[model samples]
Target chain A: MQMDKNSYKKYADARAKKSPCAKNCVCAFLFGGLICAIAQGLKELYMTFLKEDDAGTLVSVTLIFIAALLTGVGIFDRIAKHAGAGTLVPITGFSNAVASSALDAKGEGFVLGVGAKIFTIAGPVILYGITAGAIYGVIYYIVTLIMK
Target chain B: MENLIRIPKPVYILSSASVVGQHEKNGPLGEYFDIVGDKDDTFGCDTWEKSESEMQRLALSRALNYACMKDTDLEAILAGDLLNQCAGSSYGLVSFETPFLGLFGACSTAAEALLLSSLLCSSHMTRCAAVSSSHNASAERQFRYPLEYGGQRAPTAQWTVTGSAAFISTSCKDDFAQAAHNGEPVPVITEAVIGKSIDAGITDANNMGAAMAPAAADTLLRYFRESGMQPSDFDIIMTGDLGFEGSSILCDLTATEGLDISAVHCDGGLIIYNRETQDKHAGGSGCGCSAVVLAAQALRGIRTGQIANMLFIGTGALMNPTAIQQGASIPGIAHLIRITADIV
Candidate 1:
């Protein structure tokens, strides 16, 4: 039962089949690009009648709403299955996570279930993201002052 | 070879019951289950944890009713869940006032419970119950995210079954006679092989099928080798919840060992759901996945003489959120039990 590291590694390599990385990558890239293109087009449409800052925010909000709606109706999960990281790396994926958690908790009750679990998935992402950004900002300030 | 335990006396599976959530009830094996909860039947519990306890309570109640016995009639109860510290089983079966042996083998808890129950009944000459459950809400919150999170699931991810199942085993021959009189034939436990932990160094928590497949292959090979039985000896060799991907890996690994079980092999994960129509990417995984499938479907097949003998190996991935976050590999284990129908 005790195998050497080399033998175990070789055995694991033999037993674990190769995943279709090429297919997965192609799908992810194409789907992710297409989603970004759609967002770009939506922004363009809004820019025609709105201020530049307003158009950018409007486009992001529209994408999040669409993603949440798709997730609520169970369509986003299906897309994520085939799209893989393509659908996940986009802002829409974040919306999907929030929406799914809410829908999942809806059965328990709106207050404890939906309200509490609504940010379960997205909460950490936002928390770490802001922390990392602040840390980088402080480092940049120190570096600039030291150089001066 | 060291892990094998051959039952010296007959251990009769007198009766069993399965209760599943609405999603499973709509699946292919829906008709085989004893009870199917409605969409809101979260047992009216406010939390997924409480709902999971309700699932176990209901499943045990139904199984006892099927056997025409109460908690007083049972000597001991073996049960567990996917929750950390196994809160589901403790809270669920506490009211029964029966001595409980709480276990945690991830999704393999069902097989572990059943195997130990058979041993206890065979050695002590008493009746015991083995039960296990897993809820989609509870398991999801524990292992990954809450259901409402709508995070994109990896294609390799499996759907946790929202269900529970119970099996009543007794060494008393009179129980078999009563079971026969009631038109339910008993299945005898012949042997069990305990599995050693096999870590294939798989790091992805989402891809459980890959993490657990090696352990399943190792256990199946060991069971066949130690028992001196070929794949032809049993009608079917089923893995607990390998789903599509893990089942294939198991087949390929076993084939390398000169055992070809592709034709006689099936998976509980695959049997519980329709892959094409269900949208369950890799299929079902969890304690309830195999427990309910075997209780409701395979046992019925054996009782009706559709299946004569079966080798069931429950596979489990021994990993937690802390291990995954620390970048530790998932270690896996599998336990095997042989069940044979008693010829009338």
Candidate 2:
């Protein structure tokens, strides 16, 4: 029953067969690109009826709303299963997180359940994001004052 | 070396029940489950934690019902879950009014509970119930990522089962008393091999199958050697929630020991889900993964005379996030229990 370290390592290596990462990567890239293309198309359609800044904000809002709705209906999870990181790494992913937590905590009532648990995933993103932005603004002000 | 402990008296498994979530309900062994729930009705509770607790309660209640026993008749309930401080099981069984023993063996809680309950029954103790459960959302939020995050999962990552299983184990007195009325084959707990914690220096948190594979192989080898039994002795040898990768490693490691179990070897993780279709990366891995499969599928297989004997090796990765983040190697354990249809 005694196995040498070399043979054990070899056995471990044999067990750790690589999964189909290349195929997944290609699928992710293609699907991710397609999502961006659709977003751009939406932006273009909105630009014709609205100003540039309004269209930009509206496009993001539209995408997030769509993702949240999809998550609420349980479609986003199905998409995420096959889409992999393509569905993730986007604003849609953020909306899906918020929507899913809200749905999961819905039975606990709005105050303690949905109110507290809704931010379970997105809380860190907002906290660190604002903190980093404020810190950068302070550094920029200091550098400008020194240059002047 | 003296790992195998033979039961002095017969410990009969009277009845069992499995309650699974939506995904598991759609799996291959879906028909075997006692109760299947939808995604929204996951245990019909408020929170995922509460949902998991409800799963355990329902499973235990159903199992006892199958045995036609009430909570007052049981000596103690041995149960556990893949949650912080075993909260799922404790909260679930608190209302049952039965004495409880909460165990923590990670994914191997099923076999651990069974082994302990069987030992108690074999020693002339009153009948005991063994239960274990895991919720996908609850386990995911605690261990990896929350559902909403849509975090990119690695292929090594396994889906935690949202299910629970319970079994009623009694002494020969109760077994014979029941057999006079019931015509089902009595599945007896014959022997057990308690495993030692084996560390293979595996650190990846996602790749738990590999982390626990070495422990399973070690336990199986020791069980065969100590009990003086060979691979062909049992109809089937089952590993608890090892998934695909771990099962392969188990096969390779046991092969090196000159024991070929390829023909009869099976893994609960692998059998619980369809690896190709279900997005369950490697397969299912949780306390409920093996527990539900064993309670529903394997136990039924034993009862119907499809399988005469089986060895269930419950494997677990005994590493918390703190241990992993602090660079501690993931240690694994596997406990073995032999269940047979034939009377001893």
Candidate 2 lDDT over A37-113, as tens digits, reads: 98899989999999988998998899899999888776787778667778777788788888887876776799997
DockQ of 2: 0.34
Displacement of the residue B23 alpha carbon in candidate 1, Å = 3.3
Put down candidate 2 lDDT per residue, B1-344, tens digits, no spaces: 46789988888898899999988988999989999876664567767899999999999989888887888889999999989999999999988978899999999999999999999997858599999999998998778765655556767778899889999998855454643335657688999988778888777787788878888988888888888888898889999898888888789788978889999999999998898888788889999998999988888898887988999988898879887878887888899999999542
TM-score of each: 0.84, 0.88
Residues B1-344 of candidate 1: C-alpha lDDT, one tens digit per residue: 27679988989888899989988888999988988876865877877888999889999988888778888899999999999889999999988978899999998989999999999998874899999999997898778875544345656778999989999998887765545345545688889988778888777777788778888888887787777889998899988999877888788778988999999999998888888898787889999998999898888889887888999898898888897888788888899999998853
Candidate 2 chain A lowest-lDDT run of ten:
A1-10
State which candidate has the highest TM-score. Answer: 2
lDDT of each: 0.85, 0.85
TM-score of chain A, every prediction, order shown: 0.85, 0.84
Supply DockQ values for each candidate.
0.30, 0.34
Q: Which stretches of candidate 1 lie over 4 Å from their true place?
A: A1-91, A96-120, A123-148, B177-184
